[model samples]
Target: MSGSGAIVLNETVHQPTRLRIMSMLVSVDTTDPLAYGFLQNHLELTPGNLTTHLRKLEDAQYVAITKEFHGVKPRTWVQATAAGRHAFAEYLTNLERVLGVRARP
Candidate 1:
């Protein structure tokens, strides 16, 4: 939805960790792969916790995961889908408007 001067996101993406994950994905360019360990350390999540969250995101089609071997180790890389980016941007825009930082356009 359009707000003061930006778009807004629905309440569906309000969770802190999910938001952070989306934020981080938006910050990257190219297909720069990220390891599960990277997210684990960054998000301070246990393996199970991270997997559970990732599964939810994946089910929502907000993120994609690729499983492969990195040399001798299995690597899991995460990326946000186009839909995810749009939703996150909308959420931020709406949030900005709610915060009175933007005008509904």
Candidate 2:
């Protein structure tokens, strides 16, 4: 094993797609969830790809998904939970620890 410190990463949120998703979700006001279509477009991911990433985060209780129908049209919304934000913060700290340095930019 490498001699790196015992830094633990939230592997679920560490996935690139999921990282981007959580970043966007946390940046927004927690009151409103990002619309499914908007997230797909902004992340430049296909519906299926986004859904797969979302399912992982949802399972981790990091992302909340809401589904409803708008005049018979199905709509989905996603937001980062408080636990998600805390976990993301810890993830960053661990990453910095593993790097043996920290920079915010």
Candidate 3:
């Protein structure tokens, strides 16, 4: 697909918040799941807004959400799945195609 210049967009990951979410996740290691609170704070999104967007990502199987108990407290962590990683990479390629920006090797 590289050099073919075909612009293929991943609609699931194309939403503004979703795109931002994938960008952040791609920057971190796969095993390093982010806390729910951290995402809400960093994205500046309300709890309801985050929840809705997360549900969409989860439904697409692009993100995996884990809920565990920290003693009496409930903790939720989110990470991108392999599928998400691939989708994000493809999204970047599409963005580059749209911008006519060639990626450096």
Candidate 4:
């Protein structure tokens, strides 16, 4: 716990990889889900590595994963949930406070 009223970072969203993933997801339109492969390639993360991070976010109810078949191939899609958006926003606020910065409008 943080003492002296210091701000504490959210462990779940504070991890570097998870933070990057959340940033990308949060920046996109909620209606448009990011493809699994796209995230992996853009982030330069291995499939397993990306999966591991995504699983953690999923467990925290911060992301939604969908698997479906397109043609004969399976595709995976991910999107930030409403709860995730709110959580990320709060995380940013806490981070700004800790860094002595102001929130964005």
- Top candidate on TM-score is 4
- Itemize residue pairs with steric clashes in candidate 1: 3-104, 4-103, 4-104, 5-103, 5-104, 8-90, 8-94, 9-90, 9-91
- Across 1-105, the per-residue lDDT of candidate 4 in tens digits comes to 267887888899999999999999999998989999999999999999999999999999999999999999999999999989998998998998888897568
TM-score of each: 0.81, 0.86, 0.90, 0.92
Clashing pairs in 3: none
Better of 2 and 3 by lDDT: 3
lDDT of each: 0.78, 0.89, 0.90, 0.94
Q: Clash pairs of candidate 4?
A: none
The Cα RMSD in angstroms, rounded to one decimal, for candidate 2 relative to the true structure is 3.2
**Candidate 3 error regions (>4 Å):** 1-6
lDDT (C-alpha) at residue 57 in model 1? 80
User: For candidate 4, what is the TM-score?
Assistant: 0.92
**Candidate 2, residues 13-59: lDDT per residue as tens digits?**
89999999999998988797899999999999999999999999888
Q: Indicate which candidate wins on lDDT.
A: 4
Instruction: Tell me the tens digit of each residue's lDDT in model 3 across 1-105.
Output: 447756768889999999998888778999999999999999999999999999999999999999999999999999999999998988887788889898688
Q: Model 1, range 29-94, lDDT digits (tens) per residue? A: 736756778888998999998888788788888888999997998888898888777877878877
Residue 14, model 3, lDDT: 93
State how far residue 78 of model 1 sits from its true place (Å): 0.5
